[model samples]
Target: MTNRSEAGWNFDNSYAWLPKTFYSSLNPTPVSKPKLIIFNEKLAESLGLNGRNLQSEEGTEIFAGNRLPDGAVPLAQAYAGHQFGHFAMLGDGRAILLGEQITPDGKRVDIQLKGSGRTPYSRGGDGRAALGPMLREYIISESMQALGIPTTRSLAVVTTGEDIIRETLLPGAVLTRTASSHLRVATFQYAANWGTDEDVRTLADYTINRHYPDIEENENRYLSLLEEVIKRQASLIAKWQLVGFIHGVMNTDNMAISGETIDYGPCAFMDTYDPATVFSSIDRQGRYAYGNQPYIGGWNLARFAETLLPLLHEDEKKAIGIAEDALAGYNEQFQSYWLAGMRAKLGLLNEEKEDETLIADLFKMMHAYQADYTNTFRALTFEDYEDTALFGSKEFTQWHEQWQARRGKQEKSNELSHQVMQSSNPAVIPRNHRVEEALKAAVEEGDFSVMEKLLQVLAKPFAHTPDQEEYCELPEPSKTPYRTFCGT
Candidate 1:
């Protein structure tokens, strides 16, 4: 066994200092015969971890839950969340946040284990995750980071060498996840619902100091903190929309307080232009559908705002007023972000007042024509087509005329603008149909070729590769509908 000081985890954990109700002190459930499938060396390097050490026999055992790492403090956090618009008490049911690791760069990242085993928050279900979901998270989380989004990165994946029965028998796996912190919007709600007003205030102060330090000295510190988070969420979700990413599950618990995307369950990038697109089997009501994401995000943030009211002002009525004001900024911030993203997608610069109309016109045309979302943007990179020929339809051609007139004002060359737009618009995303195909082959046929190929293509999503043109194709019309599963 390694000594506590040997693993480089020497400091005290602040989250553990909270009330007993805030978390459960538990260690990870040890697995039988653990074997690592993959470890993210790139991410480990970014965290200043010794990559070779992580790949060593002793480190693999620690990450796979077979043994605790030196200086590790494993605990399951407690939180209450509004699941599908209804309040429910929840927490790290299948996860154990190992502890904070301070990188040499001075960044603090939480080391957590998913599919580690049952905890107090397990709630009568198996705490193990299947191999497919584990790998899916590893792929998507790393891709999101490459795209410059704030997200929880996957560090390692290990097979338990055991089976977990979900629908049919499936291979169980564990994921070592890294995040700025495991705090969610639900964290604050849990404290408030438990009648811990002082704790709620303390949490808000902690969060502000950690993430939004500049706002801490403000007169309306809590309210300012709420506004800042709303702005961050607004910008983050807007980026997701611009890239055709569908989170599928946007429950309050899955929404990170630090504005990073977390919990990639049944998530898929859209292949077609449908605002009502939803892939998660559990999302039957379309509550968290593609177009509804921004609205749902605002609703989730409002819940977080309500939890901070007690800390916003001493008077209840005044507090409520302040919270409402902060809530009101969400929509405006979201629209500003959405419009800016749309402009980039259209290769528009120096937004004129009428730029919003031009962007809206493009989406209306796309939705009406049912264009393939990824292909539409990607096709613009085809050098064979003249810039004007990009607008094949008369309706689209009219909008192109207006766009070019606006483009003429830019000092940069048109070639430079086109290059920038190409990078922003991805040539490939983890298409739902293809992801399912890969999952089926891996599970039913024990083939990982499809999975490996898609991962390689997605790693350089914007590059044009003639040899990999098959990756850009949409699903066949005959095999039109593809339903996704939550795999719970």
Candidate 2:
């Protein structure tokens, strides 16, 4: 064996540099009889790792939390947040950061093992993840990455060979997650809540340097960073809507400071159109529903703005003024991004002021008729004046007429625009009912074929596959499942 100091990590290290009170310096609780269940070969290679090695004993040992690798600085991160509108301090309760890995492409990504075990922040609860949730996260997160959404990717998943008791007994598991960094808005709030202004400023500056470097040259660097984050959040949500994704939980702490989507808890994709759609059972109030995502995002950002008040300006009045101005940009940014996404969904090219009216009218009709969001868009892929059977309603025809009327003014052809819309609108999504069906089969029986099939279909969401038209159809009225749950 190589000397500890001389041995290469196959990964690098970068601490959060947080104050002692911000986090508990705890290493992962080693697991017994750890066995690798899944490893993301493509993601491993993207990070300049050996895919073969990842499938080997050494990789399995490290990934399963059975052995801490060289250069590993395992520590649980800390942060505070508003959970379901109530303030609560939370941290990496069941997760420990292994360190950072600089890819061959020169991108720095965090290597974290989640559900490894309890830490100081466990807060009187067991810090273990069930096998079903671990598998669901792996399937859904990788699907999100394949869909081109900015998200945290799953690197590996391992079965802990130990049982955990929940409502009933269940198998235990751990997930290795990768991202730019795990810092969240809640991270800064933790410092502001318990620590001094100095810690807030340090975090704000470090975040700006790491994620929003271009803002550093600006005069109001902190304000600039806030504005940039607002824009990113807006665009991110817009993209989610475009692809029929629902985050399910949009709590302040879950909002990543890196502006990447995190925490796949109870998350799902829309199968039918409904603005008030909510799948997460914990979200009984429907706060983080499909249409309410943008609003919830704004609320989360407001919390972040509150934490940065001390750094906004010297005078209390001036600080509020600065923050108000920055926060106000969220609505405009969200509108612009949302409109662009809607336009792409409908296959509109020219920027006519009337485009908004046409899109709004379609949504009104959709809401009125209880239409299927994914199917409506997928129907547009086969746009033929002769083939009216593909469209479900006269309302779609009316909307199409309005869209064509506007398109008549553009320099593009109907065929060209249709092709563009087809590409923008996906043919398949991880349907809520289907995902549930898959999970049920996996949990009740040891069958994962259904889940594997769904994964394969979603891996190329834009493509039309033969003998898979069943996957594209909407869920039956009676079969419509609602109220998903946070596995924890």
Candidate 3:
């Protein structure tokens, strides 16, 4: 009922000052009632919010978009996207950005209310979110941050006390999320295709100033901006590969300009080391499988580069050439990052000419043996991989000898190699079954303890503590391959 000035929300409302076409100003359609489900205390404090003040009904309502804090200006952004490879005009259908907050570190970050309500781009869909999906985002996103991956974060999830009709009457909820900025590849795409050339230049300049400030004075700032984004995305995808995280839906719009992992929709960490592993129910073609992530990352970035052609050079041909030259290096850049990362995982201190072959052969064997990805790496790091069943086979026995021989050539001692491996591999991930178990408990049984414990375990992914042992083990095999829905 009252503004949350006491909650320490210092809103700057800068994005709202953009041209009207960039967004549409609106208030969230009020929910019947809002009940707080979870609050991220550490993130709240980091953003300079008074955590105690945000734990009340008033706080819950603020996230639910039923209450406004001081300096708040809610709007749904306008953008176009390539969804499953088809271009479409789209915008924020169920999410509302409530101004950028100036954090204690003096960083400007977007605070968005997802599942807030419908806007101009609702497209006849109910702009409400279900409780299960909201909680799923909270668990996975927070886990990503803990694992040192750049990502948008979930601050709170609040129940709307109303049913969101999907296949069934599921309870509605709202997720208060935060990110460096919500600028996506689709944002640039929209400006390029629909808005004037001036619009594209304006957005490119704004993005450089905000995300790549050092590049602001570069001779070719726009081209330099593209190069920086390409580098960032290359490294980010490499990290995702090392950890076996699959972003099931990677529509260009889902690709954030800040290079953070955005949208947790239908995403999952792989249980086994199969490159073809996929969990998204909608991604039947496997275009975005675990193994194809790097290629898809390149594909999405190419789409982004197209949006910047006008800003890259004056002559259309020269622009194409500049973009082509820049885009051409994506594979090399991605390979450089991925190779370096894989080397760390295998505890290889010094690179060898056959390093790529060594890693490729390992993956081939893993695919053949169905070895658990995270567990195998963790066991190797801890020196217990020899006890695993995968090592019982003759093929694995020979491979182990080769790996041992490779390690013998390392400049550092075995202890240092193991240390590097420990940091490179995670002892735990948000297992799909465990995540479902927590969601089922919270949404069906009204229990939060399961999720809370899982979060605690995930917070220290490399800790290797006894509490993480259970999570380190994979869930019992199910006859059906796991399927995840967008749950929008």
Index of the highest-lDDT prediction: 3
Return model 2's CA RMSD, one decimal: 2.5
Clashing pairs in 1: none
Residue-level lDDT tens digits of model 1 in 354-400: 88887778678778877778777766544322322235688877876
What does candidate 3's lDDT look like per residue over 1-488, in tens digits? 55748999899988887788899999988899899999999999999999899998778889888888778898999999899999999999999999999998999999999999999999888999999999999999999999899999999999999998999999999999999999999999999888999998888988998899999989999999999999999999999999999999999999999999999989999988898999999999998999999999999999999999988888999999999999899999999999999999999998899888888888888888888898888878887876454878888778888999999987799999999999989999999999999999999999999999999999999898888888877788799999999987
What are the runs in model 2 whose C-alpha is more than 4 Å off?
1-9, 384-392, 479-481
Off by over 4 Å in 3: 386-389
Model 1: CA > 4 A from native: 3-12, 381-392, 445-449, 478-480
Compared with the true structure, the alpha-carbon lDDT of candidate 3 equals 0.92
- For model 2, residues 225-312, the per-residue Cα lDDT tens digits are 8888899899888888877789998988789888789999889987667888888988889899999999889999999999999988
